[model samples]
Target: MTSQSGLTRRLSDADEIVPDSEYVSESELRHGSDQVVRETSRSLHDNDTDAIMQMFTEKEFETSDLLEICGPFLLSDTAYNVMYMSPGIINMIPDTSGAASLPVTSLFHPDDRPILTETLSAQTHDGSIMARLKLKDCSYAWSNITIRQGNKNIHRALYISNTDELYRSYITQKKSIATLEQKAADLTRQLEAVNKELEAFSYSVSHDMRAPIRIINGYAHILETDYCADMGEECRRLFDIILTNTGQMNQMIEAVLGLSRISQKELFITDTDMPALVKAVTDEQLSAVDNSDKINIETGNIISTRCDSVLIKCVWKHLISNALKFTAQEATPHITIGSERKGDKVVYYIKDNGIGFDMQYAEKLFGIFQRLHKRTAYPGQGAGLATVKRIVMKHGGNIWAEAGTGMGATFYFSLPVTDQ
Candidate 1:
């Protein structure tokens, strides 16, 4: 039997290995020892020492030769003792050695010892196992070990090959996933902070800013009510201009606040009937405006969709009211609303016969305070389209318009189809 120190020194030097059967080359390792053992055992019974002599003769081969031809492997008895180790195995298992004394388990990582032990302990003794095997440098390499039983003097043969590259790739993949998860968490925190700032801005616009405008408008109204009759024609005209401008400013301020609210509002999504929602908004707008009986309203198969009912209603109110306002000057104002299926989405459009702007400026139509017509000609702060655009985008939809001067404008929006 060899001592632990002796085994370590021998292993470090890359010495001989033990195999379960007669001398077999590296290429023959997978073939198992059944045929070799049977032939060698028969030869031994006939009093021949040729096989034994050949094993020692092959052992004289250089370690480099073994490394090139064979990977690290070991031969052990049924009790798992270190018997014969190849020159390749010797260079890998540097810490222990003994003739039928040291267990091959000593060369395995502590974490992998139980796995190998359980594999060998199984009823089917011949099986494959994966574990980290110790190297001469005291590190470990991932190795696949296959143990096959022998019927001769040797009990089992252990064939081991390194799979370190595959193991390292798995480790790298885990690290990359962790990094992505951390980045996602950071982005969520940043979004939350931005939303909080928006909330505060909305509050300021609703209260801090509107209060002074309200006071100015109130005083202007009082002056008109009490002093308009006493003023000269020029003075009265100037006062009227002041009152009108102040009122327009208030409307602009309200539009800005509405835009802010749209951004901050959380969506309450649900299945809503498109025709019902549109008709309701249209009725409300018509009842509030003049010539309710004059504007010709038309429709098509506007399909039902999933969306935030309140926000979607706001969208309809803006579009319908916009159509009615622009078409008010026409002798026969016509408004049409309809939808059509386009692939996986439902495209809804509102068109009106009115004094439309040129297509070249279409891109600016949805921007806040961007207006092609003078406020004197067509009154609005130009935030309605911007608000509508925002609401549509939040629903994961798109909005676009097409028109020419003196012709009608058609505003189209698409929503993802949920029913289908």
Candidate 2:
């Protein structure tokens, strides 16, 4: 049981005494009783007086005793039995400590000491010491303290509590939050870097790749037209193959150039006839190949919705050409262009009975220079599909493919009729 300081009355024997108003308690009367008079009589009751005087005179207890003058009084070792005062008297007398006198200054919280002392001296039973104490090994502690009173010989005690564990836990949680935030920032930076690289690579595909392709294509055109008389037929065929390769290179370069251009174009948005546009692009692509007699067009009425005609026409051109190229061996290649209305948006599908792709390599298909088929088998620079993807994305549309190895391919694209 923790003891607190308090005050109470004590009964005593009547005496031939100075009939003053009141006398000290039995505990306090240990110094002198009313019957035991002393008038500079040093030799009289020398032992008991010295003991009581020693308690007051000792330098160790002096300042502590001064503080206890306004503290609560309690029995030495019990929290149950206590003594104190009324509100008015308590208001008059300011209390300073919560427990009995045993050096509490060492236990004082560094930040609380000054405020505690000044506020304690200012008011009685008002304010409390609620502070974190500095402990060993740089830890913290918490305590709630209040003032109490003892006998005329005032003494005080201080209460303490430790909070090192809770403080450590709080610090750990804050560090976790900071670590997560830092990781998020790192990921954001990494994403920005990846986007920049993609943009730079797209620019290279447009500018760097086309310069050499133009030289080869222009020279090949001159050779096939003007130098046909000088070369053997077999040699001419080889030159024609070279011309074909250069033309394919030109196609790939244009695809990437158009992709890069879509990013910079002013979004001149207006309602467009999607069905008519698809038909027109399909006819133009097939006429270039001169293979429509071999490849069959599926339907006259597919779907017409709002879109950028030039951009959408480019999209149709690439999709249709890819279908024609891959299905060249088919005796009757079938290509169907259609659109499905999903909720408020329209999704376009170009279904082709062609040499389709495997689903496993779906993620890599849109990457520039990533080719699923060998050059001997497919004969492309591998950028046409990537261009189609970029253009759709720039228009706030999503494009995807569904195909299985040896099965036909189906391309789907979704777009909102409204522009942002």
Candidate number of the best TM-score: 1
Compared with the true structure, what per-residue lDDT tens digits does model 1 show for residues 1-420? 112223222333343433323344444544553454454455455545565456547874454453444555688887777787876677655656534377767788999888777777672556788888776667677788888788773578887754335345645775898999899999999998998888888788778887887788788878877867577889878877887877777788788888888887888889998899999999899999888888899987888899998998988999999999999999889999999989989899999999888999999999999998887888878898999999999989999999999998999999887652
How far out, in Å, is residue 94 in model 2?
48
Worst 10 residues of 2 by lDDT: 1-10
Off by over 4 Å in 1: 1-163, 218-229
Question: For each candidate, what TM-score against the reference?
Answer: 0.63, 0.44
lDDT string for model 2 (1-420, tens) is 001111111111112333233433444435443333333123222434454355458663464443444332222112212233322222222243464542233334667767755654553432356655444434444545444433342433332312323446656776898999999999999987987887888878877887887898788878778877678889888988887887887786676666666765756666787777877887788788866787788854566656677787788888888888878877789988777778877888888888898999988888887898898888777877787888788778899999987677888888876743
- Those runs of model 2 whose alpha carbons end farther than 4 Å from true positions after fitting are 1-256
Which lDDT values do the candidates have, in the order given?
A: 0.77, 0.62
Report RMSD (Å) for each prediction in the order shown.
Answer: 11.9, 17.0
Return the lDDT, model 1, position 233: 84
